[model samples]
Target: MQPYRPSPSPARRTVLRGSLAASAAVSLGARPAPAQARSGRPRAAWGVQTGDVTSSSGLVWVRSDRPARMVVETSATESFRRPRRWEGPLLGPDTDCTGTTALRGLPPGTQIHYRVTLADPDDPRRTGEPVYGTFRTAPARRRDGVRFLWSGDIAGQGWGINPDIGGFRAYEEMRRLDPDFFLCSGDTVYADGPLLPSVTLPDGRVWRNLMTEEKAKVAETLDEYRGVFRYNLLDHNVRAFNAQVPSIVQWDDHEVRNNWYPGQILDDPRYGEKDVDVLAARAGRAFGEYFPVRAPSAGRIHRVVRHGPLLDVFVLDMRTYRNANSPGRQADDTTGILGTEQLAWLKRELARSRAVWKVLAADMPLGLVVPDGAVDFEAVAQGDPGVPLGRELQIAELLRFIKHRRITGTLWLTADVHYTSAQHYLPERAAFQDFAPFWEFVSGPLAAGGFPANALDGTFGPERVFVRAPQRANVSPMESPQYFGEVDIDGDSGELTVRLRAEGGTVLFSQVLRPGRVGQ
Candidate 1:
């Protein structure tokens, strides 16, 4: 079959055209397979997932092999003899046969067992196999404790699904820890990464990737972008992990392409088209369709997830609102990393939050310098050592606002550097002393190529307390180390502990912090 070619015209860049909508409508009324004696088997292609858990509500997601109606039966008991059934949206070709159901009015701080059933659209009696998953609702008040894991950069740099050893082993280890939820910081899929069938390792061993057509090249069309997401589900470990643990997901540059910004023209010769906005639109739509997340206002993915009085996670959308990567830095520069509106929203949320610990779940680090190319950079810091410039100015202002507002017990967690490390930022060492001292933990490459740490931008005065990574770049998972970080907030003492663990679940570094003691 010939690859689908999308028109690169500016007029057609706003929306995805062609057979997408028509096929979606036709799929809605499509007939299901004929019922057989054993038709009750579950057919969840991507397994079951529950996310965005609140005091009274949560989101459940599943995908079917064909057009079907998603039905979720929930109960407090594992047996689920008298479970309550909730109907989900239609699973059709429009959303690539994926659907998410909002499970609302759930009891706070209670474990809810759910079984997902995908019934044939034509014959409701003929259902696929049922998949079981579980999630705990957020507490209504301060409770015993809260534990969650966080990481990013999955299936990137030729590190694709390996059928021999399940998928990403880190996920298996994380599931063993059994945290309340998983914060997928960013780089959920490398839309621009190409995966080959096989490659020769440095030790003469053959490393194989479970290949698919969409992952063969850079994602361009809607199908190719959807394929990128589907490729990750090929890993049984990932599917199993998603089923058990709820995921709070966000996106960085790799979902569309590395170091991409809105309105930027593609200069890479590998892509036949030049406009990046069209590709981003397709990628964003696919991301929304696949993940079990609430639609954000104005299409921005940045939002807050409050877990009672113990914790409040602020998931930042660093990719959506940003300025073009350039060399210039001025105090009065209107262009920034968080943009104007997002920056303001963050401040308002921080001030209004009543949780004991305000965790800034950021996609990118505040101080690390991620250079896009020879003259451009991707994150807040632009490699300028001393003074705040350009994007750094925005970060400086936000940090200053946190200090001015007297927001205590705030921490930043990120995972784009592909390694694990604990960094301490002190006001005494910083050029700008208006901000309070805080710790930022970084870990990941959950199943991607591992690389050495990037240089720190001295604007924030980050001191590396601990660093664990290979000296070389793009090392395979078998040869290199992978890491994930976990946060434990104690209900009784109100103490927060951060742990950075390796692939085998070994705690490489740990730190304990208490409220009101920051910067002391």
Candidate 2:
């Protein structure tokens, strides 16, 4: 976790953006102005969302402007006729005024319409306007088709919420797709990437950022980390999108710092606190409070989200239990990117899964060369083209297990390189050829700065069939359209189609795979 001295490279720390536009004050909608939170009966302007959903249960989340009692009413229809009432937690500052309500006994494959009401903690009659939301439960039968979106790297590299171009435009675009759920691959918050008021772009356009005190610098304290999440929620498009799409959220290094790991002390002068473990702990707490995830334990971020008979998403926590960033040339390293325990858990879950498709929702790309500095590596792969080394050994082990065990219908989805690409890994072309052929889809930078593509490591024998990356390093969103990926599973045909999409509904790349099959 002790990353070396920072350099000006785009792969290291994200470069910032340009000046504030005159229309910077424009609101996205569900986010209220500062004054409204002060004088009103507890407001739910932050909006409502649900996540980790199953056929019979899910988690509902909301935030209040003040200390209030959370109340939820759910019905089959939006009309609220014969609704079931669920009394939730008492929102307070302990959790940054945010809390999640666990809803159970829901109808499978049904659309759930729910509204969140924030009642004053002391006054029974004083309440805020209800913030409504909806989500579809996982199907109980195979005949029900399923669809969902996956993307990450939100508000990173100094490109923050820009009200002028409509803050976080990608969320609005993704919300319209109406996916059953969104797998927020990782880097859900750029706590380390601070916002500047404005900077002049290369082409003379002034890119303005919606700034706050905590966003002005790196998030170090717990409140500052909470502000990082709160800052993103200020975008009206994000809030509006949350009201519709439930998300399966996870975290990456940017949630705490750039290319961070466990137990490393910081060498960077930008930070006053040198211990990274302390920083990661605070970041994890804020992440749990902000995101609607069904973590198995208090600090666990890895879990399998079962979506009935069609799919099961194995969300990985590459950041939490990872071995320190190294040169990645170790001969015998059992504790690599995913520590031994997580690897075991993943193997157990993959073996137990009976779904047609098992999506490995990894925070970082598997075969890409993500460097921690000039020497150390960040992700699963380094530039080595030889047999499995360091983290590659762990990945090789997992792949060999899949091939040997005859576990079918597994693919990888990730977003950290700030680009969209499709890669196919074949054992025939790999140094360690004990694995079956599989596909890995990458997409992201939801509302952040885009960067050039990273080089692939040959140990996995990955062929980049398709890629859409920025021409230069740290390209602002204005110069590049944001990206996301979608998956559609046909219940009748049992075929899964993956589409890499850009902002404004353009499908950049796509591929189709048959169920329980390989080498598509």
Candidate 2 per-residue lDDT, tens place, 304-375, comes to 989999999999999888898899999999998899999999999999999999999999999889988789
Best by lDDT: 2
lDDT of 1 by residue, 182-295 (tens): 999999999999998888888997778888878889999988898898777766667667766788888898999988998999889989767889898889888887788888
Give the C-alpha lDDT of model 1: 0.81
Q: Specify the poorest-scoring 10-residue window by lDDT in model 1.
A: 11-20
Angstrom error of the Cα, residue 278, model 1: value is 0.8
Top model number, TM-score: 2
lDDT of each model, Cα atoms only? 0.81, 0.85
